[model samples]
Target: MAPSYLSIALIVLGEAFASQLPLFETSSLSQTHLTAKELISSKSLQDRIHVDNLLERANTLYSIAQLGEDEYNHPTRVIGSKGHLGTIDYIYSTIAQLGDYYTLSNQSFPAVVGNVFESRLVLGSEVPQSAIAMSLTPPTKKKQPVFGPLALVSNFGCDASDYLDLTSKIALISRGDCPFGTKSSLAGRAGAIAAVIYNNEKGALGGTLGTPSPDHIATFSISDSDAALYIKKLKDGEEVQASAYIDAIVESIETTNIIAQTKEGDPENCVMLGGHSDSVTEGPGINDDGSGSLTLLEVATQLVNYRVNNCVRFAWWAGEEEGLLGSDYYVSVLSPEENLKIRLFMDYDMLASPNFAYQVYNATNSLNPVGSEELRDLYTEFYTSKGLNFTYIPFDGRSDYDAFIKHGIPGGGIATGAEGVKTEKERQVFGGVAGDWYDPCYHQLCDDVGNVNLTAWELNTKLVAHSVATYARSFDGYPKRTGIEATAVLDVPLSKYHGPKLQV
Candidate 1:
């Protein structure tokens, strides 16, 4: 059990000390409480899910992201950023209110965090277009830029041969097929002094290299239109040389994963749910994940009022935006015995895209674990019972569930959508723009509180409540977790992906 006194101490210290924590709120402690002895059910739990509570949480997260403006120059909650630390404290303090009802532990880990001080990209005498330095990339020297003739590489720069004959030149690569780190490394291997990646879609590009790569050269990302303009010039027999300068810093920073498990249930058979707590370096990520994070928070808060037959673990993962660092670390540290105790895992991400679709992960794929289909059915059934239309998303490993799924855990979740375009058929099912991106502000400076669609978010939050309550009551139809040795690893090259649809 967690040290119950810690919760008491935090409460007794008054709002002064807790207020010192970023975006701390005392208002949550006054919510309506239910009788602890009442049996938990789907209705009882879902009844407690309220839109007002979620909206308030969204406002708090937006406020937390704003706190970063003084330190990060933008509203952000990227790993190791001030806004992210505040998010951690806020979650910790909120869960701390449960006292010993939940066993809480802050799992600390080292992560590589990067920030762009400044970056500039110019295509031979043309006005400089907007660009952002890819995370974990080394910066160009002060006042010294990397310049050479521009050569658009064949394919997506996933292979070294694509950069042949491009020695000392700046390689222009498309965004797809592999990770940004792989592309940058391939460019460097071909003797390219610098590399530029353009978005496959019609927006400004923001990307990451996944991890530090010694072979990586200074890299920058530009929009698709900018790249098309330069591509046309080069194709029209015009010589295009590029000069790029990026001033950035990459360093190892300490961060933590917040894990809270119920103390009143069966520890050996646990039901786990999680969402990424940290956002991208862009805007306040209320929809990107703040929506999902608060879903878990609100559920866990109300969950304490009832008893459960199975232990429930609520994890607010850190460093997820930096390539699932926190969740991966969590899985790596668990012993085989400890891992088997987790019967199933559910992930919640992007529950509130402004242009939304009801999406549940497709568990029918042969790649999923034994019980995955059952988890999917639970969600589809809930939506069906409500006469709500939902679609199936591929198991692309784009979120924190990647680690658990990789290790053969039956995992499932819901998402409104990310940068992927919504289909006309989806428009017929769920009202939204068919040809537009689900969340246009995905990983951009506009994913603030306003980005969330409260209607969609509220409906998904109730689904989350239903899933938690059902599993907490009993894992009756759910398959029991088998020994680790019998589990087969999922055969997806998930590391190559950086977004919802794009490979890089």
Candidate 2:
């Protein structure tokens, strides 16, 4: 059982949590509410099943804690791709440490554009000394100031009409309703040499958000602090031009998805639990996903020894911070046949955002809900019994699950919340303060060690173990869960890939 407060929460769960508990669990089957205390002392399910040991292995948050920004953001996968090497090494030093039934797989896919627009910025004066990664093409020359070469987009918040009015200069704009990528790509299509996006928000643009620049266009996000001075000068009738250049050069660097298989007796279908291991160049994402990455690795270690009824594959995706590249590619590379073989998908993106609220992303009808409707329904029952108040967070299909769903695979997962926070309505439902940031550090440098909500992370970790263990133990026929909306046309294709129809 959880602490006293949690018990009260169960009671306060009132209608939804109370009535749904029994339906979520059965006597022949175990409930998903196994606490850390119970998990530590719980005996093996069968001679081959040991959930407690799995929890212990899944609790290696400290070792991942020791990983510096460099290691967390870098590639141990120097051979085939960049990212976690353990995923591909059928034999891993990490798995050897577990000394159990864990199989490392190359988990390799026909590499997609893992890295696009690797750039550097050094604004001499007009733009202060800062780092900016615009979705535009990289500059051929090193470190160009934001003047002379850049063109300013006047009256931004309005239509991009001003963009069409301008000639072949790098369009300078401010961030607003539209994404930087969208704006850059727009300018690029209009013959703009590149894009210089001055910050409209208060401080720095922080970290890379998404990859919108399809290809060939150069884009850069200038600091708002620095853009202020330029804007002030320009507004005051002082002409300010930036010397910016973008290199739209193409490169073929290998990127891989880490895959580790947990074998059981019968393996007609498989379940996937993963977190992207790649981090931004700006900082090591110990928390942006390090929290989740470490958590996923721990879960895999603990269960590597479990003997179960279904196949469970643990993955550590790369380039997620870089727009779900690793997960997207792995799924993109899979043949239609391979995709159909998947039973379900789970993502552990930000398991612990320091001072964050507990949240779960619900797969929707349009997203194919990541997995079969049956899985979503099962998860709903699982969370209900656990007394967890879950919000039906829309699936962005921006995680590894995106690829799986693209191929019609079933998917779902838990999240600790990100930049999106709870509104007054949300707070009312989940009990967190309204107006509080979901994760203040979100993707910034501050998302490092010592910045985590241990309780939230611990609970989520346990949730993963419970959900995964229960999933493995139950061998329901893959009759295809149903009842969510159909996949949306609004959903973008999984990858920016176009290869020989990838084989399963």
Candidate 3:
């Protein structure tokens, strides 16, 4: 027989009490304060926010690894070996602090095969120099490589035909039509032992391994400037090889993923909220998502107090900086039933920084629904309701949500911005100065806490919470934002969701 509503309520209640109750140093509630007319006459709602103590605790918790000062994107100095591990560790700690309101787990995957490196290339000659190798890459076995120096040969903007004869040779090229994995596969197919990629442009490279290849080979990247120096030397016909090694054997070290939850009730109805906690070895990533990570923790902490229906989850993913490795692994492992149970995926990635504008990807191909006009309207409505202003954009269904979208989940999310400086047109839209970075710190060391615009940061977090709660409250059977109409929603066409195309 189906479990009775009372039975489910009892179980959820037990779980809620299972953890230490939220201390609610401040009453954990929504932005609406009833004292409105009386208080609004003088005070600001922002003033009522309990920032100091929360910031202290959050900083105390988030400060692990003294990450603010760390060079790696997501180091787990206090938890696991890599930055992703640190993310899982934090989720676990938060779960414990929140009294097991949720349980955190990890999903491990191997992408870049063959020899791995321990110390992430902090900045190979330049901040954007090191191309992110797939996790499947094995660790370099020796201090020095059998091959003395590697060559910097252009793949001709990722066209493999350029370097046809590279057997036993390592080639450095740039990104183009081919996926990184595809290029690597082609290089492998060409008998080339390995390949490295260099950027043609100045910004950070955001694409992941384009296609998945199982070749056990050494593959990575060096910046365009760094590659140029090598290229010049090679043009002069000088040997340009370098040794490579990493102790990446599974036995060498362990990896983990931490998760938390609002309350999993009935086990059938559940909602999820998550982000990759693990950072790259590139930069500190306070903005790449340290801000989002902090936001997730704060929202989870705030939501834990209010009683609700359905299971709501908070997951801090690892290895996201490593091409969404952790979250991908997590999604790949879910039972078909579990995957279906996740009605929505509200992903919070790099939202706090004023550097970038905001975008929401509504993926329909995967488990999630496609980007709909209604979803956009919901965001605008939520923002306006909270007295914040925002422009609704389309969905670019990338990121870990791909895992869910693939499983048929209705995925929608918020991102403050990435690279691509805000244009005058966008300035007219979002009201920021033109020529400013959409997310200047993107993958750089400058992605510190200071980069976050406090107002925007706080608003972004609140907006996410509002969206999640609205969905949960209205989730009688279907995933819908409360009081929102289908017609009112803005649908970012699939083409635009991935951003614009170049004009000839």
Candidate 4:
């Protein structure tokens, strides 16, 4: 059972402690006399989350994706695709059927969707090697293939000198030191027709150029082994001829963000939780965010059985894969009065990576909002109480929480893992392979229903439920809302921070 306190003491002590702790505060004590609902405990809500039921729902979503697979030529729920539209309809219809318990609405916005039809590299008549085109790169308009002599760029291709006179040629560059966009821009400035960036490590390179750039020529990624072979041949005084072909589509499309808010709770102090509803072009993204999306749906359904003091809003964000587009748009459109009503925002993305670790966002370090530390501590306490080990992920804006924190809303959340390789120490603690990706099939076609770690998914969902239930009852230890005008963080471009480019 959770601890309890007297109403006056809770509020008075909260104010007294607010000076010492930036993330601590409480609502007015006068409002304590408001009629309280017959609420269920967090443990009761956690116990109500059945793993079998969760899996069954997840499988149904996968089936929906299967039905919509023909449109995209792959099983994906990417925004503006049939699969994602179906996903939105399903979520909206399901919550709408819950009677008058919640108020639901679909917030529509325009998003630039990028589709790579086919990308290839042919090296001197050898079999065409598989390559992934950088997202948002303009498709080649020329009918003839771009054929030119390949020249190696010096020092990761980030400097002007690295790209000398190389008219009508292709640049072969190593990936490091800067964003893939910066390197491609340099290649364009050097008069190169295209650019191919090879991985610095021992694997196939797959990444985004961050955003659309007119200066960015056609760019593709290749395996480190292939790059090494090309370098060796060049070192041996052999001229290597390369041909690059890319078929892609980049266009603006309309998408929706599903927002549902409880009707019975205090509307002024709302608790918001979200996860991206869209997937990559490769696969169904069942585990990538289908896990988080469904977990929220399941919890929201069960929460209808109880009541709360503060409103609970569930947001299924779209356009996260194209650089946090949907969530950013949602925050950008909020008026100052509307923004103040949101007390805090919690995000959940990739909650069930196969090589899982219980990771809470480390709000104590970077990008800490007023009440972020308290949110982090709450999650930490929840896992510790369950006799489970946990770790902290840096609070870099890599998920839906990015825009919320940037807008001064206290934020925190959990992730099982993404494409990051697990260390030996992490393996010992989490009981998974040391040198393998957290989600081996991340952003790939195999990230279907079977890719999730059921144990991790179930446990993380329970923690989410716990957080929701605790905050719904009262904002005893949360920061008081201040109607300060929020400055747009999007005005300044997001830096070239690299990691697993899963969601955001």
In candidate 2, position 73 carries an lDDT of 55
Highest lDDT, which number? 1
Once fitted onto the true fold, the runs of candidate 2 whose alpha carbons sit more than 4 angstroms away are 1-91, 108-132, 135-137, 149-168, 173-194, 198-218, 222-252, 366-373, 422-436, 475-504
**Clash pairs, model 1 backbone:** none
lDDT string for model 4 (380-423, tens) is 99989989899988776678887777777888899988888899
On residues 35-72, what C-alpha lDDT tens digit does candidate 3 reach at each position?
12131100132233343423443343334434323433
Model 3 bad stretches (over 4 Å)? 1-54, 67-87, 100-163, 167-174, 188-253, 264-266, 362-374, 386-388, 392-394, 428-433, 476-504
lDDT of each: 0.81, 0.52, 0.52, 0.78
lDDT of 1 by residue, 1-504 (tens): 123323332342234332333332333323233223666789999999999999988888877777678777888888876677778777887887655567777888989987777778888777446576787787764536888998888887888777787787988899888888889899887888888998887788877886788788888888998788888887787889888888888889878898989877789999999999999876789997899999999999898778888889999998888778888899888899899988888999999999999999886535677887898899999999999999988777788877787676788888999988998999888998999999999989999988999999999999999999999999887787776543423335655553332337
State how far residue 409 of model 2 sits from its true place (Å): 0.9
Estimate the TM-score of every prediction: 0.86, 0.66, 0.66, 0.84
TM-score of 1: 0.86
Alpha-carbon RMSD of each model: 5.4, 12.5, 10.1, 10.8
How many residue-pair clashes does candidate 2 contain?
Answer: 30
Model 4 scores a C-alpha lDDT of: 0.78
Kindly give the stretch of ten consecutive residues in candidate 2 with the minimal lDDT sum: 495-504
Runs in model 4 lying further than 4 Å from the true structure:
1-37, 123-131, 141-144, 153-162, 174-178, 199-204, 223-239, 483-494, 497-504
